[model samples]
Target: MDTPCAERSESYIPNAIVGYGYTEMAMQEMDEQGFGSDTPSGARRVSGVSSSRRVDRQTGRAGFGAQFRLRFSRSVMPRTQKGRIAGAVALFASLGLLAGAGYEGQHFLLHDERFVVPGSSAIQIEGNSHLTRAQLLSVFGEDVDRNIFTVSLAQRRTELERLPWVEHATVMRLLPDRLRVSIVERTPVAFVRQGSKIGLVDRTGVLLDMDDDSETASKGAPVQYSFPVVTGVSEDDPASVRSARMKIYLKFASDLDSSKENISSKLSEVDLSNPEDVKALIPDHGTEILVHFGDSDYLDRYRKFEAQLPQWHTQYPKLASADMRYDRQVVLEMQAGASVPTNNTQTAEASDPTPAPIKHAAPRPAAKKTAAPERGRPHTKLAAMGQPHFPDESAPTGKHVISSKPARQ
Candidate 1:
């Protein structure tokens, strides 16, 4: 008997499974089971069962156990071959369009005239006092005419900082053909004498190029620095050591300026050749008087010398030097052949008469006395002028007096 169409449709394999290479195999298995396209209901049922058994046995032996079961479901499989091919082509097309857009964008940025650096006037530079605008243009080089987007900002900034006076530099693109550059300049604190050449130096002892010509020399000569000169530091010295010496020089200069008497105004030169001993020369009465103040207690020693200057000037007309390296005392070195008073005794003798002598309890030994010279003239001596006076307990009446004695010549 012929099978009903509805019954035959239930036994036929769906098109979803045909894409998985099951259409020809299912047809061959059905023909072997004595069933054709016009098969009876009973034969169709037999063919369907036989084909399912053969497929499961082959796939299980081939190690596609789960895949074989998944292939039977229509919803789990790809609907058609044409849909997958179309999707792949669309994916490649979209990627190509994106790459082309990116390339065009890059090209526009590189060649756009609006983004090109217009001229030197378009570049806004600030915070530069030692370096001129023309000098900065030379540093930019070929980047001057290039588009702003193409300019290497980091490279330009590094070149700017390499300048002698620039401590730091920052570069920015202001868009539409403009660039902004700012600099932090190093400030000169003193003039450093390196061999015969003198150059400006900052507080950190970094030598700087004097391009501004702020300090002038003889007619048509190069610029010279007028800042206080610092010596004893050489180019061969280590950077750290030079920096340390600069700090010491600055400290001494500051101390001199902050003194009660403005010694810095009178200071023409400072000798730092000896690190442990700092000497200052003061111009007094058409001659320079050397003042030796040791490394430590500079301000205190300076004040002491200033206080005793008038007294020493009066006593010795040509006071060449006063050494205050000692504590509570200053050694006054007078000019050669300058005559000073022998002692206070001559002054006292001229003003008052001699008093009574002291008496001892027992008979005292005779005090020895040296014979005077043939000329019978008092010999010159060196004396400590500013020694702190303490009351003499041995005296009949205790009193603090200005101590003066003949200095040994």
Candidate 2:
């Protein structure tokens, strides 16, 4: 379809006339030979005609169609330096976006107005005991009471928990309107008598000087009404006061109950000041009972006394005082001149001498023997008085004739 020169031109020039498979193989050979269209230096220096006619020097393979195919393939391949720069820029932009998003999220969570606390419309107190609702409200301070938004529940709990009677406490924010506090108060065990005033005290001996109210006082506070009045304990010694008073009351109650069980009279009082030598002032029995109870172990000693009391009462009916200081032995103090078993230990000796019987004159109108007064021996004398030696009918009231009885000598 062309002249001779035209035909040569057509064979070397890159065209669509070449079949697809041959063009591909020829292009691969040119690519391996370093003859590609992407090299701007190569494109400008080499004439398109010569480049199309050039052969792959190593493979001896080439054609205009093959060179054109190689050029197209090379143009499509990415440049390494440019591609790396683009990828790095994209990564940086993505990281910046992520960091900005995270910063915004944190700001919202920490300081946004949405997270601010709502105003307080109601106050929910723990209780009215120990510390009243009014008193606790005062501790919350003006800021917490005015603007509820700044109220720190944790801080409030920390401040109140320092109180000795408050065992534990929790402060909670009631959403939209209120704050509620719940606290556990320590139970008062006994009331300690402190001078003219009484202090409410707990089992641990912590004194609470709060005003008197039924709720703040312990359940057993009223039971201390009949407590023995004690002195010498100072206001500074709240712990010692509590310990001493509780010990006395507990011992007295235990002894009284045990005595009733044993048919013995109730104890008027029990003193624990000297714990080892506890003494009980018993009823009108004329003497105190000395009980040696060491430490706070009166409960055990009282039970022992109860068990042995009935036996002693039956054997020693005339006993004026009983000493149970030593657990194994019971000492009895009896009325003067009363007969006691010889085996028993008598604490006191006999007081006076026994009188000798007088010899009466022989019975009237009966046989009489002449009597002679003995001399040199201790002389016995009987003198007559105007009112008679013995009390007569005119003796002062409340006098009675008693037969001569030998008293202790």
Candidate 3:
């Protein structure tokens, strides 16, 4: 066993080993790693795996053994291009499996009877006043008996908002077999007359129809509001225009009501056609007198009108309208055709409708039957009926267009 030339037999046995054994350099390297069994220790130890480790002073492990272990670990996992391809393929296969599993799970949720919607009873609706349960259920009618996961919450919300009463709405899945619907209804601020039809409108100018309860129940839709009937806002007008008009109307009402006198309640209707004029019809004696509140200074004008009303009514019993656009002076119009005959009565009747009454109102020449009356003057028919008493309900009984803002005269 110690002989170096042990293979040199009689026939040589056709070189039993295919190639030469470890070279001198390999043997040296192996010996450095404490695995040179071919050296003097070959008969004593089979391999370096079973031998005692020679720990280094610095690393606390055999120097060659530790380096060889580090190198072996690096080589264990393939770094070749082919090996990388195989690893990538395995990663892709794992991802595909996960994706397939997720698809199947979602399909189950979408098709399972447990997740199917039973009926409208399974839906929870809240914050609805004018919106009826049946009307709301119609929006999700297609969802009945279908899996809840298949119902589009966003689509349902969009449909709900399209209703006249719904301002905005939120839809959510309650899991399993139910859905939760939260609605914010539009609040009607005024009664709007658009063309021939009368409907309720919110602050944003959205027209709404009365719900079944309000239409047929004890409380009528119009009975809910005590505010004046609004005119000039119509469906033909753009949303922006309607909104703008409503803004002015709201401001006028709010400012007048701020006094706590509830001065807006004195009149029955408000005309918003001319934003600059903002005319309000107030009951004067037996006639409905038009008062121009103008665009701003609502509270001040209302108070001034209240203070000077009796004086104006006392002088002109058939007062038709008073223009309050002027700060100091007001254009007064008594029912046209009232005779201005006597000097004392004509002077008092022709005075300004504002707080400051014109002093010594000179009498104008009596109109000859042959001559036509001057512009801005009442018709002769009205002048002939001295002290006329026209019955006025103070509410809009028919359609009428208010004149544009009068020119500064």
Rank by lDDT, descending? 3, 1, 2
Worst 10 residues of 2 by lDDT: 383-392
Provide the global lDDT of candidate 1 against the true structure: 0.58
Q: Is candidate 1 or candidate 2 better by lDDT?
A: 1
Top-TM-score candidate index: 3
Model 3, residue 359: distance off in Å is: 18
| lDDT by candidate, in order shown | 0.58, 0.46, 0.61
Q: Which one wins by TM-score: 1 or 2?
A: 1
Clashes per model (N, Cα, C within 3 A): 4, 0, 6
In terms of lDDT, which candidate is strongest?
Answer: 3
Candidate 3: tens digits of C-alpha lDDT, residues 282-360: 7654456667788999888877766767766655555666767777656665544443223423444344332223333
- Report RMSD for candidate 3: 16.0
Per-residue lDDT for 210 in model 3? 50
- Which residue pairs in candidate 2 have backbone atoms (N, alpha carbon, C) closer than 3 angstroms, thus clashing? none
lDDT of 1 by residue, 106-213 (tens): 999888888988778888988866677777777776877778998889999999988878899999999788989999989877755554445567887788755533
Tell me the lDDT of model 3 at 231: 71
Where does model 3 exceed 4 Å of error?
Answer: 1-77, 80-86, 195-197, 212-223, 284-287, 336-409
> Alpha carbon lDDT of residue 303, candidate 3?
74
